[model samples]
Target: MSPYYVSYKSDGTLVSGPGSITAIGNQTGASSYNNRTSGYLWCPTARDFTVGSGGNKGTTADLATRTASICYMRGLKERVEIQTSSGAPWQWRRICFRFRGNIYGASGQNSQSGNYQTHIETSNGYRRLLLQFTDTSPAGNQVENALTALIFRGLPGTDDWYDYMNAPLDPTRIDVCYDKTSTISSGNTSGKVFRKNFWMPMNKNLVYDDDEAGGTESSTYYSMHGKQGMGDYYVIDFFKAGLGTTSSDVLVFEPQSTLYWHEK
Candidate 1:
């Protein structure tokens, strides 16, 4: 179970489902797709990143009985939020995940016997998975990534946490940061790497625009896909008092880690 990325079209088409981990960058954006402003886009919604040994998710395993990760989340909050140098915040549909002691399933893309679905919100202006992972050790960043959790507010404290095996009516959000390296020439030598925040950073550069498609491990991604694709990865943290301002705004109903979201 090697951890990999997934993609989808703006219309929510299943372009990269289970077993397509190695084919992420091989599609070679078609000329017709290049000119079009919207169509298929790369998303960062990582499923089955952690699975119980009971068996493939959604089949033999009982998600509620297992612990996908651990984090405290109240429905009243922003799904995803990013702070900046000016202290402005960027928000989106989000869910939270705890990376500490997390047993990442390499075949994270597989555990599922079929298409899995996590955050399914139908009660808001929009829908998304606001994932939150808290690591106080260190921030490991890469030169190239599909997305980067910039620290515009403040650094994480010693204690923080993400997702539970079973998400409730409302999900939580996680914030990941990776801009703390002495030299860009060298590699990020921090705890973020151990947390598995950033993916392969050696040969590929991450782009948010699907049109910027090209790379090896991760290529171009577009948020315009409308919360489609595997659900784009987001950088968020809006609840620490010492760092800056925080909130508990609700976006949509939180998603659960059921067969719909776990196995393939």
Candidate 2:
């Protein structure tokens, strides 16, 4: 059957026609039942990652099963530590993902069967996904620290080392970076939260370049590559050392929400 789109116009007039598909594809911001952007806001929790098909083995199709909680490794110490420009060792203290909707099935805003969720769950096109973060640390002074998120794409029983390292435009991994502010939270923690947003392409043909303004994905740091499919998982990596010069000197990462667009 040919595809059809249904959405309301800016004036609130309900409309459905062959052209509605193009209208939704042109949406620019967050995807909603009303906005009709070819996207969805994914709010994943610790549970979504644990119940998947991988069996928590961190292997080919089992990468999603590698974590018992929202945080990577259940314990951050297992993460590889890297040297920063200042010669101080930096490691990802806490990398995680949280969402209200399920990435599978007809849950939350997903339709039982329609173009909405299926666009992402079973099709390949120009797609994009984003994660929103806000630093709520006591000092809020993690300016030197860079926020990094890794987007891994694959399906259960179908992923392998070859696709992750050698895929053309749609590699199996994508690294997105953002900047942290140096300001301190004021009277209330919410009043001074430093917000950072990172967007990663969900399709191979799309390219996400690092911000040259001393941001994380700068030429001095890493390159961006990767895309997500039916099975998608994201992990945060903290780069730059000495958050506060002590074990407690760590950056707190709370993923506010995840947004994505599946473009035709």
Task: Identify the leading candidate in terms of TM-score.
Answer: 2
Q: Which residue pairs clash within candidate 2?
A: 43-99, 43-100, 44-98, 44-99, 54-62, 56-65, 56-66, 169-204, 173-226
TM-scores, all candidates, are 0.19, 0.21
Q: Tell me the deviation in Å of residue 79 in model 1.
A: 11
lDDT of each: 0.21, 0.23
Worst 10 residues of 2 by lDDT: 4-13
Question: Tens digits of per-residue lDDT for model 1 on 1-264?
Answer: 112222211212223221111101122111111111001111123222123222332223433221222111111212211222222121222222322111123322321222222222222211233222221212331211111122122222313312111112112222222222210111221111111122211121111223322652222212222332222332222211111222221111121111112222
Off by over 4 Å in 1: 1-45, 48-52, 56-235, 242-264
Q: In candidate 2, residue 37 scores what lDDT?
A: 15
**For model 2, how does the per-residue alpha-carbon lDDT over 79-181 read when each residue is reduced to its tens digit?**
1111111222222222233212223323323311232221111121111112222122212412101111122333212443221112121133322222222
Can you tell me which runs of candidate 2 are displaced by over 4 Å?
Answer: 1-193, 204-233, 239-244, 247-250, 261-264
Q: Number of backbone collisions per candidate, in order?
A: 37, 9
